[model samples]
Target: MSHTEKEATLYRMSTAEHQCPYGLKTKHLLKSNGYTVDDQLLTSREETDRFKEKQNVQTTPQVYINDKRIGGYEEVRKHLGKPLPDPDEKSYQPVIALFAMTALLAIAASWLAFGSFLSIQTVEWFISFSMVVLALLKLQDVEAFSTMFLNYDLLAKKWVPYGKIYPFAEGLAGLLMAAEFASVISIPVAFFIGSIGAVSVFKAVYIDKRELKCACVGGSGNVPLGFISLTENIMMVAMAVWMFISMF
Candidate 1:
């Protein structure tokens, strides 16, 4: 009887050169031991951002056994002596409900905070800083999207990954957030934010083809991009109009 070769595990090392020496070694050794290898080498900041979003992993050198993490280098090395079925890996959960709940609450808090900060210089700083942040994120998203055109199967053909898109959408959301901070813009801002929230709720339910990750209201990670984007834009425009009305 012929024996079947064990399936090679999947290991993702950090972009950092040092954090995953063991993972690299494991890849090499696994090949020697007759197993296949898949490597997710992240180079762009946006790629790193997507990995973070997908895994909710804060650090790099994340190693996975067939999609499960055997921890990092040390952990993998330690388990090297174990049998092929290590049975000691963790599964990655894409949608974390607790995180999603926290995000919703944070968005609510942001509206209140921005509303209170409008009279202060923080509004200007938040607007400018938030734009810069979102712009950088958008640039990264564009680059990632372009790469996906050539490798559609590897990456979903979405315009941008959810992690990257969230920040882009947030740019518009921030504008509205900023408007809410102004005393003259309060009612408009409230209405705008409220509108965004409503649309977000609707989108979360209605969008069928949506695969984008939610980056709304503190990374609540639930709202869909379609609804949230529209919601935020509406709020911002409404706030601007309300600011005009409040002036009189």
Candidate 2:
């Protein structure tokens, strides 16, 4: 076919009650890729079912190219060489988003408190906010986080309960640090956990040369354990030390 003759036929459900989003996406993709679409709508429930039965297909948003069945949304994407994302793929998106959001929040918080967008307190807020958010992510599935934590955490390996308690401890330290209250308690807690975590991550990723998923983002995430994971632990350690010195 000529460049201007690229043609596609789409059969998608667009009933009065329900509209399929994937159908819209497929249509948009076809148009963006310079295809002329012969849009066919299965307007009612009965009509959709009959169309599926006649076509011998189970799903909506079916695509046809040159009268040959190109399949549904996902299959059409594959035919166009644009496959869907794999959730289990190892990526740093979760951690990157977390740090970026916390940094912005810190700046906003500093502005609210000290009447400036950037300040020493902004750095403190960033660390505390990150700790709280990270702890919250782990708290989503404590059992899962604990299971993963035991893989590299020395304390968790030694005392199994520590795996479970780590999230709560981290959160408490963060809250106390943010409030600038009970330095005696928060300082020590942060320092102890941070120190242990830094050592454990160093041993696992650098010394032992192990490849593992990081629980730093969440139990279910697939972000690889590496320098970024090490950086998180180092940040915690530095924050704790900074808090201690500032207090004295």
Which candidate leads the pack in lDDT? 2
Q: Write the per-residue lDDT of candidate 2 for residues 1-248, one digit (tens) a residue.
A: 58534799999999888998999999999999889999999899899999999999999989999889999888988988997898878999999999999999999999888899999899999999999999999999999999999899999999999999999999999999888899898888998998899899999999999999988877898989988888888888898899888977
| lDDT, candidate 1, 1-91, per-residue tens | 1223344444344555434565566677656656556666766567767877887877655556555566555565565664443333322
The list of candidate 2 runs beyond 4 A from truth reads 1-5, 15-18, 43-45
Q: Tell me the lDDT of candidate 2.
A: 0.91
Q: How close is each model in CA RMSD to the real structure?
A: 14.7, 2.1
Worst 10 residues of 1 by lDDT: 148-157
